[model samples]
Target: MSVDPEIHWPIPPKGGWTADDLDRLPNLPPHTELIDGSLVFLSPQTLFHSRAVSFFEWQLYHQAPEDLEVIREFTIDIDRRNRPEPDVIVVGETGCPDLNETRLPAASVLLAIEVVSEDSVERDREVKPAKYARAGIPHFWRVENDNGRAVIYVFEREPATGSYTSTGIFHDRLKVTRPFPIDLDLTQITAKRRVE
Candidate 1:
């Protein structure tokens, strides 16, 4: 199913959203960036997805280099037309300050990690990859919890026209160490959490 045109279409806002405009929004319901100009309701995270994100965050927090900074579900303004909040972002400590006011620049982000949920799998797997690539974000990781695995897609080279050209898929219980050096044990990361 196509996203509602009114919701997902990349239209130019009359005057664009400023930091003040973003702050004025009420905190009742959470919203997400959609193709820069529009905002859409963020779907609630499922138990499985939530657990996975927690696990990944814990691992990354302890294993990642001390100099690197990691943020969970933070928005980065890629351009005037695209703003996506990936599940996680790892960047150098210098680029992002300790304030929650501004949107991080895409160029400063070393990697963008997206944890897929049932409702957002298509967008995370397909739409976001191309978007991040076009924004020159360098690397994108897609974690599929339904199958209890993660697919690491590296955009080493940019495509001339469409999507990223140089892509690599790593499976079969491997360690991830490109964007940031970490010996991620996939099996441990995907271990089933006890159901409540």
Candidate 2:
């Protein structure tokens, strides 16, 4: 018989846990998010989730212009009550937070990407995109695993209507020109590592 370690969940302050509370809260699970003033704990990541996030992060960091930066698993300050962390974010250099910062203002985010996990399908597919568009983020990508292959659903915000318009869906490769030109081989996401 084995004993599991104890986990402590913080009590929310007066109204509820604010975006700022995430940084101050003690013993909260790693990758804890705030959605509508409530705590949203993430389930353990799967190999596909981790690989897909790494694939995009690496590709974006190498291809993005000097004015933009790629970040992984960092929260965006959507509102006082919602600070959701996207799997990968491309942010303009001017809006990049300092070394000590834990989150970025959604206004500065050029693109937000979420790699779907079994537990986060609804939030990633629906809720987060709506909020990201409302916050004026220019682009969003939701990556889903279809029978062990990655399918990328790309969306760009319509400036006139302030809603996301489906740009394109990439199955084997992702090539997009808006925000910046990026072309990546989706198969690289699961390639075996070479021992050098």
Candidate 3:
């Protein structure tokens, strides 16, 4: 949650934010994402959100296949107007881009995950999923906090319409085979007060 407060933002160009614009911006704090040509500065994560992300970060990293990598807060270039920074991404090692690069192409991505914050409800539920689906990302996962309990909703892409269909909904535990075999006890994820 240690984000820089100083950022000199410019008036968004008549054209929405594109990959070229992202390259031109002066280095601002991390977690800046471009959506529809506008700079979407993410709020510093809250404890609830942070714990969930950290839990998954470890889970995904250890359980992922040797050929795939699990990363967090990385941007995916969805298209001309959308580059979303997903909370957790599982991408193929060979398809992965340089780690120093800010954006990864959708083709390299196997999964896109968003852990919803109160501020991100509408965007997570609607905007991002639409963009990822349009970009043909094969899988998407949304983690929701309901009364301090985490509920994971899984989606798989529908090739015909570039949309996602609800594949599973998990609460107590997550056991899935797509995007790699993963078996996580969700109770341990949200119940912990500290990450370590």
Candidate 4:
């Protein structure tokens, strides 16, 4: 009798995941926040997405009041399980830190920006806003690159419900006229593309 030695079943990895488990994963791909004990994979941002971020960053870097410091793509740890990397963050002078750390304390973040990618739209629009609001981070901005245009969503107040209720959307032609102390020209700001 000949045995079918070629037939075999692969065993899956064992056990649940924790934050420590996440730390063990390979550093090649970027990871994101999940509920209590899971890992979420972050999709890479597209060229358009990168452009929008750069444009906004340039404007804020030069135009924001000298007292406010702007940081890019830094993780803000809201809890043991929720750490989000906003595209651009405005932190008060006292709260800003040296460049050695990977995470920022929630209290230090004054404004958080998330540039929407196709793969992350739902997570950006729904999951993260709720998380930020719960953390009592005062301001949150969502930059959506959809249909060859950019739209900005500014949440003024912390959301009482699961998502931001008080919001403003600025299109390409309109100026971002609110969020005092930082005057931004939305049209000119979003027009600059990232150089290759």
Ranking by TM-score: 2, 3, 4, 1
Q: How does candidate 4 fare on TM-score?
A: 0.76
Q: Number of clashing residue pairs in every model? A: 0, 0, 2, 0
Better of 2 and 4 by lDDT: 2
lDDT of 3 at 189: 67
Q: TM-score winner between 1 and 4, please give it.
A: 4
lDDT (Cα, tens digit) per residue for candidate 4, span 10-98? 22144434344444555425645544445666777787787778876777888677888888877777776767778888887766667
Q: TM-score of model 3 relative to the true fold? A: 0.90
Once fitted onto the true fold, the runs of candidate 1 whose alpha carbons sit more than 4 angstroms away are 1-20, 148-167, 190-196
RMSD of each: 5.7, 2.2, 3.8, 6.0
lDDT of 3 by residue, 1-196 (tens): 7656675557777877686677778865688888888888888887778988888989999999899988899888878888889998988886665657767888888998899997889999999998888888899999998888889999999998889999999999999999788999888766746657
Off by over 4 Å in 2: 1-7
Best by TM-score: 2
Candidate 1 lDDT over 145-194, as tens digits, reads 53656555455435456355545565545455566666666656656767
What does the lDDT come to for candidate 2? 0.92
Better of 3 and 4 by TM-score: 3
| Model 3 alpha-carbon miss at residue 42, Å | 1.1
